[model samples]
Target: MGWLAAGADHEVRLDAGRVVARNRQGRVLRSVPKAVRETEAYLELRQLHEWLVRHETACREQVEQWLVRSLPVPTALIVEVWADEAWRAPLRDLVVMPVDDAGRWDTDRAGLLRDADVDKGLGVVDLDGETGRLTSTQIVLPHPVRLPDLTDLREFATDLGVKQGTRQLFREVWTRPDDADARRRELTRYAAAHYRELRHLQARATAAGYRVQGGTATVKIWEDGVPVVASVWIGEGDPAWETETGPLGFTDPAGGPVRPDDVGPVAWSEGMRMAAALHAGRVIAEDEESA
Candidate 1:
């Protein structure tokens, strides 16, 4: 009863009346199928992935439990730490994955373990459905992982910046068609405004001699192709902004500028600016009494 955990270039094959699996590195892993259903090959791969995740979870939970009992700290302190984690940690990172299913391991099922602050690691696992003989290989132990305590100001600040930046950028760059509902239309307009502003800022900054990195530019258009400035990206040395530059036909090695196809809803402030400019040309009638 052997099993294999393999990857993209590797697969389990029924060879010589036995299951033999190879990884991308040409290494063979020992594995046995827990269940085999005749289905599309893709579905089979998915099933194996599911099994791998389950085994990895079981093993990681066991490790955490062992840590609680084995640590030399007082039981009260351990309990407090556990309670704190239970309440605060979103526990999202606890979900398992297959980082390098290609690596050969002597186990029935295998995957990867990833946590917020630690490097992802390989997991080797085994399972027995009938008598519940679930086991794991205790080889290549992973580095210790610690989840961020939300109260940590530094981590909180970093998270805040990422969320705010992503939300603002996404809304500004991608827009919806007129057939979209009011909610969708509003979102497109918001994104358009953001794009236009970013472009304007990038141009101004670059012209002033600051290097703008990963910038985007956007313009709004009517369904019939009338152009208006919708939004723009303005910053120095931010690589993540690269994705939002698509509104321009091509991203500038130095920056991006919006074109007619990028149009969406205009911000009220933008409209007001146009009105102000228009009024600037008008002459006011003089009051006879004051004259």
Candidate 2:
């Protein structure tokens, strides 16, 4: 048998009654007998695997945070990180925008990164659905925060045959319908069992940048300098077990009810996103009986 996988910059192989590690030059670095469960070589290999897993997770988490917050990332910073294989793996094939010297996203210069070239700069598929090279000194990784813009970007990327390895956080969000009266009615009676406990849901909502109050989750957005607040009732339940959620409610800064039609698109989308997320954690009827 030959090496089946590569890990921590070394080739790993299961040999005759042992595990073997080899360097890039095919030189045997270490071997661990199958009977030995805690040899130095085995421990080192385990540590390497653990480190690699943590590195991968850290890279993805950092990138995801940037996307969720719609933060502007410098092109130079990305290019610098691309030099490392661990960081590059998560960033490959993501949509990136070139930033002009003025520190603004130049949509005209945006493209899907095919490769990060140290010498020639980035190889990309531009908005025109054509392959091109972007040699700009600075670029911005725009978060897919704008729903309409994200849709157009996906369509453009599709035309160029660009496929991303990681999830696009700023993708378009789906809502049930635009009918205010119908949506209000649905929300009034909405109740779903969450897979997570009430406390867990509340904590998650708070960590996601929402306000947690009296066992309810609230998100506030400003429209034209007026505060638009949306809140969902998260019922109290055992902290360690799944719980059910209560109805969702929306109100203005004055504590007055705001109709769905009166809510701006941004606020509406964010409010629904919170509701849908909590709803997704619902404990199914079939699972309840099993438990």
Give me the candidate number with maximum lDDT: 2
TM-score to native of every candidate shown: 0.17, 0.61
**Candidate 1, residue 165: lDDT:** 12
Candidate 2 lDDT by residue in tens digits, 108-194: 766777777777788787666688877777765554544336777777766666556556733445344577677776565445646
| lDDT, candidates in the order shown | 0.31, 0.66
lDDT of 1 by residue, 147-230 (tens): 112223224334434232111111212222345354333433322222223444455434433344445333222221233333
Where does candidate 1 stray beyond 4 Å?
1-96, 99-191, 194-291
